[model samples]
Target: MTESNDGIDRRSAAPMYDQLRRLIVEHIENDRLQPGDPLPGEHRLCDQYGVSRTVVRQALGQLEHEGLIERVKGKGTFVARPRTAESLVHTLVGLYEEVERRGGHVHSDILRHERITADAEVARALELDEGAPVVVLERLRHVDGDAWSLSTTWMPEDVGTHSFDVDLREASLYRLLAEQGIVATHGVRSAEATVATHEQAQLLGLTAGAALLRLRSVSRDESGRPIEFFVAYHRGDRSRFEFQLDADSSRGELIRIP
Candidate 1:
């Protein structure tokens, strides 16, 4: 709504959609709109806010992205249910175990999990000579039905990928590796906050400039031979990770993975 010749804010000068989003979110915060309360109809909202239907609709979309609102097909937008803390543990567990234990469901969409010749980066990370063949595994991990993360793991080809032919939706890669006499006895992992790259954003279903958690690790056997090097990018909003100074043990000497 705008006022002429008076000391009133001009709705046209400022984006009406942003203004409407602010107004609606404020209502929810101040108790004017409760969780189950129905939002006004699209046409009605336009009339009430003195804006076009386009502006009103776009505003609703913004609220939905912020996780403050949800829209049903036949119904309308409603407040999103509050999210609880998923365990923020920093453990060297299999991706499968970690997701399940954190109260999240896990599934994988196989991208590629096969033996391949290692590049300089992969060979160095896996502690193998450059250009050596390696077992490289790539998969997209889903948690709570959303694509929570994407991972690529590299291992020396001498270890063989045959035993790690992971069932995309069922088996665990780490578990498979252990069963094949390569128990990741202990290893090191590094994590950092980062912005998703163009390629990473596409694979993770994130906006081109979204924030992400890049977790890289190198798991090894008792002999300290680097067996697997992994890199995973997790959605910043829907995922969390934790780090501990040391986890109640000092049997293995700690070293940097990256």
Candidate 2:
């Protein structure tokens, strides 16, 4: 057996694959491996750790499942980029604002921005009559120059007309609304797991049926009037939502899926 420089102990009670997984994780945490860096080939890893092909494969599989590495078909496995964590539990903020606050660059490509008749769902969410005129805004959001999410928002005619001429590529919608005295003071949001559609996959640079996080929300103004309703599809591999819970609260919260 080849001697392992990363301290893979065969005498320990832990399985060989787990030990290998730990070593690889350490290499990543210690900055020996950075995001997008190619991981050693399976055979090379097996030789380095004195393990069989099966053991190496098992260890690699575990790492991939944990989002530590991504394996391309023709291209070898590489360290995966870190996921962006978004706070959804306590804050009423848009993606652009949240990303920028974390020192990340955000850009948007306006896909569609026009006045449209509200559909049933849109009308209901905005508390407007069906077929009422509403502003529809669709954008493909990018983070660090990579496609990250597709967002579609509907706002009341009075509220949305002001945004038609606004440049929103690097601007926050919430901020723009605030300029017009339409601040979103509170909101309800829900998320679900979904697979990307063919069009969505193409725009987001993912294979068809790739995992996505679907988020839907409705924002209200200080006067308790609904101002905006939006649906966003985020790349699941690159996005994570965080929630803070209070165990001492007298009432537990329940999220209803619509």
Candidate 3:
């Protein structure tokens, strides 16, 4: 025990509560205290630091707010276990695969899957003329058994045909597509913050006028062939996006490609 910490004489110049909070946190950071370790009781803290009960409580409040400690209902205040990295949302790893990795239950329900003529937007994205044959697949995704997002895919006819197999209901569609020879090697993605339409909101079991994430992307195969055009409506409350940035030494990065 240090002489100064044991008898911390409060000066009129410095605030006592904030100083106490920093002193306690520094002890934790230096491995003097660890998670699951108990903190001194409120009365004991007030006595040790020579501070008022109010000052001790206020300092503890800040520590709890910062997630450095927790006050259990019956048990006394204890250090908190730090949180680990969690995925915000879908990336190239496949939506189903990514969610499970984050400790969330995953499910996909095929709402509609059909072969139809391409609409104007689909035609343009797929690089096909209007009325070209296209396979459209609609799916509702659930995370932890709650409705989370909706995905719609438009597969150009040049891509392998789409079908409604049992795997589509309960497995990764990307893996299924890979087995069928339409491997999605890479994609060009665009994301924007948007409000859900009335129809979309209803399907997602959300309020009629709600905010959502509108994600769209075009995936291609090894030969640089545009095969799949996908639009996903992700719930803002239940979804987020993550980006991994690494140094790219190769200056050959394609600029203005979007």
Candidate 4:
């Protein structure tokens, strides 16, 4: 092992690659490197840390996998921007309201807003009979002018009729429902990892098979009746979900997802 004067201690039991990874993390955490800042190239890193090219490559690969850095084919590697953090474990807020609360802009492009027959899955989620008439609203949501999520919502025909009168591109579904005496007081939400499909990829500006976070939720009104069911796909690389757990409680409290 080559001795390193720049914090890569060859005498330590830890591996050289791991030591380098920690060093880079420290630089990022200490603000020595800011987002979009270019990192040293492989050759420069090899000389600066007195390590082999293989060690540097391993460290950079690990960092890229962890979303701390991004490597451009010709522009070299740069520090990655922070992911958008959303908390669905504590508050019942929509994406538009949440992003606006954080001083970020939010908008949506209405894709589909017509009444359609509810399929088996949508019917089950909304507690309606199969083949029942339901309102389907699809939107491609954007945050700060970047494609963020694709959301599809289903509601019973009676409740969704009010939506046709409003321009949903700039409207909030929950607020619209509230105006019609349907308020979502609580909901059950679940999240899972999924790959972007061809259609979804095109709408979200990602390649097919890219990582995505799928969020499904069933919202109930104050009367304990299911009023809304929605499925949303969020870009995994740009979005992150946060949760707060209490050791004393057996079940974690979850809020609604928009």
Best candidate according to lDDT: 2
Residue pairs with colliding backbones in model 3 are: none
User: Which candidate model has the greater lDDT, 1 or 4?
Assistant: 4
RMSD of 3: 9.4
lDDT of 4 by residue, 33-110 (tens): 787898888888888888999999999988976878866554787897778899853466778777877898878999
Cα TM-score per model:
0.67, 0.79, 0.61, 0.74
- How displaced is residue 256 in candidate 4, in Å? 18
After superposing candidate 3 on the true structure, give the runs of residues whose Cα lies further than 4 Å from its correct spot.
1-90, 158-162, 249-258
Cα lDDT tens digits for candidate 2, 131-191:
9999999999999988899999999999998897779998888999898889988888888
Instruction: Enumerate clash totals for all models, in the order shown.
Output: 0, 0, 0, 0
- Residue 60 of model 2: what lDDT? 87
Off by over 4 Å in 1: 1-26, 29-89, 244-258
Off by over 4 Å in 2: 1-31, 40-62, 71-76, 247-250
Candidate 2 vs candidate 4, TM-score winner: 2
lDDT of 1 by residue, 1-258 (tens): 232222214646767788788877776777666655776667767767667889878998788667677555457766755443433335668768776776767888878767788888888887888889897778888776767788887888767555454465766777777777887777677677888788877777665766677888878889999988888887765654544456666455555543
Candidate 3 local lDDT, 1-258, one digit each (tens): 232445344664557888888877876777678777987778778777778899988988788656677665446877865533334332565678776776756788888888899988998888899999998889998877767788998987645364654467778777777778878777677667788787887778665555577778888888888888888888765554666655874333332323
Output the lDDT of residue 23, model 2: 83
For each candidate, the alpha-carbon lDDT, in order, equals 0.71, 0.86, 0.73, 0.83
